[model samples]
Structures are given as structure tokens and as C-alpha cells.
Target: MNQFNRQHIGKRIAALRAAHGDSLRQAAARTGVSHTTVGRLEAGQFGTSLNSTLRKIAEGYGVTVEYLLTGRDPQHDFESSLRRLPPEERNRLYFASPVTRIRMLLQFLMAEYPAEFPLDRLAARLGMSPESLRRLVEGCDDRQFTPEEVRRLGEQLAKVTSIPLHWFLSGDSGELAAAIPPEMLGAYVRLIKKAAEAGVRPDLLEMAIDLLILKHREMPAGSQNGRRGG
Candidate 1:
């Protein structure tokens, strides 16, 4: 890629990393790479060795190297490769890959919906036994999900929770207005619930307001109440 394109890619990488709540240090810890290297990679300050850098990032983000490199669909090819391995070995590599985040989220959802969508039912959907699904969810920190599998899992999760698939796949939480902070989350939940009762989508305008509140919280104490010119 040209320098401009590379820089834009770096920015995208940074945005994704930030959105995932990861820091250069966390990525370094996971990838056995240095923090400085990650910082440089995210800034497009390094050239060449781009392939290796992209590989590390793809693995870290549970994306395909091809996706990182060319923004092409790499899910099918990666998933096909994953399925060819022996079951146990595949399990090991899958858990160790970067897409393990999806596994963690699945586990979180299972816990969050224990009564309504129990483990057995979820396993059936994934074409796995309860024990296997349990293992998959429990060991997600060590597992890597290919992008296709992640997309499939996101779709399944949407079906189970009555949420939209794009929300999960694209990492947009429509309920952020009411689902972010635990403190005032109940208030927003009630608002959304009221909207549901009224048969209207809770206006995302409320969510935009909530985001501004969150942004204010992120500011320094001195800046918190200070008005700034646009």
C-alpha cells in the first residue's frame, strides 16, 4: 500500500484497538511484542515487515491476515483452514488465536441468559454438545475464532437476545444509552423498556447524549466542567 493508505490503515487499527478497550501494553502482553513496536505499528511509523505486523494484529483482533492486509473477506478461507485440523488440535489453536474475544463474549452471554437460553440450547444451535460448548466458552481466552465464525456467533446471539445482528458484528451496541454504566443503567433500561412498551425504537438521540456524558467523564477533572469553544 502507499504511504497514505498505510497511515489510514494504522488509524483504523488504532480505532479498533481503542474500541475494544485494549492498549498497546495489553496487545504487547498478548502478542509477546514490545509496546513501542505496537505504538509504532498503530502510527504507521514503521515500514516493511508489514506482513508480520498485520499477522500479529489480525491474530490479536480475531480477524484474518487478509482482512488486515487488503480489507478483503478472509473469513471463509480462514474457517476452511481451521476445520481441516484434528478436533483436539483445532480446539487448541482456536482457543489460542486472537478471535478468543468472541468466545469470551459468548461465555458472558451464556452467564447473562442462563435461565432463558441455557447452555444445552445454545450448544444445539452451534452444532456442539453442551460439554463442548461449555469448554468453548470457558476456554475462550485461549481460543481464537475466525471472522466467519465470529459473524455466525454474533448472528446467533442476536437471535437469542432479540438484538440486531449488525450490532454485534459491527460492534455497535444500540442499547448503549441504557446499557453502558451500571450506575444509571437502570434509568436508561427503563427508558428503553418504556419505548418497547410504546412500540417505537428508543431514539438513538438519547444514546448520543449518553455518549457525550461518557466523554465528559473521560476528561480531566479540571476540564470536566469547563466550556470549550468548538
Candidate 2:
């Protein structure tokens, strides 16, 4: 009913159509909607009141209306069970399997740099052949990269994209990582890692860093020694 729900439903419809190997025209024909209407729906321009239209589109894809609206297959009890777990436990389970990890990483990268990293460009950056990269991106969960290859790719990405190397490696703390520029992310990561290794509490370190920055800012103008009347 809201904008967010409309956009979410539109994206699900588009993804389902793509998965079914249907073009806009084909999907429109199947749903008995005009191609222009199908395009508008896919673009998230459809009003939320079009329940009949939504049902028709869902039927065209041979999927239930629930799946189209929620991006969940109603038949999958395992998925429902996973969502009921605690956040930490859910993340652990999600990333425990190598296939899931690979898929997550690919999805993350695609979402972050959709225009910048096409399959071939991303493959080249990772030092993988185009076909190999395509297979990995296309859900070849069994395809695994060596530790060394991952390290090399991470390092290269850190240098080139200004995204932190740890993001490429661990893929955690995305919001925090995104806030820091690539030029500073390496240093930020090193500082955090060093603090963690030394058993320093993160909150204490954050407070100390904030205070240090404030102190620097409050220093007298043109005072290199940061002392009064120096």
C-alpha cells in the first residue's frame, strides 16, 4: 500500500520474470496486460490497489501472489524457520555454508557496484577468467576461490575502489565500512584490528578516538604544538 511495498513488489515481479526467461512483452502477453503496463509495473509505478493485476502477473509467472508480494516462496518451511532465529545465530547459519557465503558476496558486490562491475570487469579485477566469474556470479556455489586468490583480490580492491579490504574478505559491518572512504578504510581497519588484538574494548577506543579528534579541533589556530600561547 505504501511506496516501499510497491517498490519491493515491483522488484520481485521483475526478478521472477527474469528467472522465468520472459521478456516484458512475453510477460505482458501472459498476464493479458499491455507491454507498457508491464513495464510500468516493473518500474514500480503501479498503484498498490491493483490486486487483480497483481494476481494476473503472479499467475503468469506460475507463482503464488504471496511470493510476488513478499519475495518468499510460501512452500519453503526451512526459510521460515531461519527467519525465526536470533540475529547472530541466523547470520552464523547463513554464512556457515561456503555456497551461501559465495552467493552473499556476489549479491553484495552486485548491489554495491552494479554499473561498475559487469561480469567481465569484475572477473578481470578478481584475476578470474570471464567464464569462471560468470559461473560464480550465476550461482555456481561449488566454485571456490583459493585463500591466496581471495587475499590478492581483496588487496587489489582495497587499493582500487577505496572500499576496505576487510569488506571484500569478511563482508561484515557494511554500513560502517561504507561511511569511510577507501583511502582511509585501510587505516581504519588496521586500527580496529590492532585494538581488537590488544583486547581493547571497542567503545573505549571509539571514545578515545573521538576525544582525540575533538582535542585536535579545539587547539589554537596555527599552533603546531597544540599548547596555549606556544
Q: Compare the candidates by TM-score and give the number of the best one.
A: 2
What do the candidate models score in CA lDDT, each in turn? Answer: 0.57, 0.61
Where does candidate 1 have its weakest 10-residue lDDT segment? 90-99
RMSD of each: 20.1, 16.8
Clashing pairs in 1: 94-143, 94-144, 95-142, 95-143, 95-144, 96-142
lDDT of 1 by residue, 1-230 (tens): 45236676677677767888888888787666578887887777775777677667766666644344444432443345457867544433321332353464466546544543478877886666787678777663332455777677767654443344554454232344333444444444455557657777445645654675677568785663354421
lDDT, candidate 2, equals 0.61
TM-scores, all models, native as reference = 0.31, 0.32
Model 1 scores what on Cα lDDT?
Answer: 0.57
Clashes of 2: 1
Q: After superposition, how far is residue 7 of candidate 1 from its true place, in Å?
A: 1.1
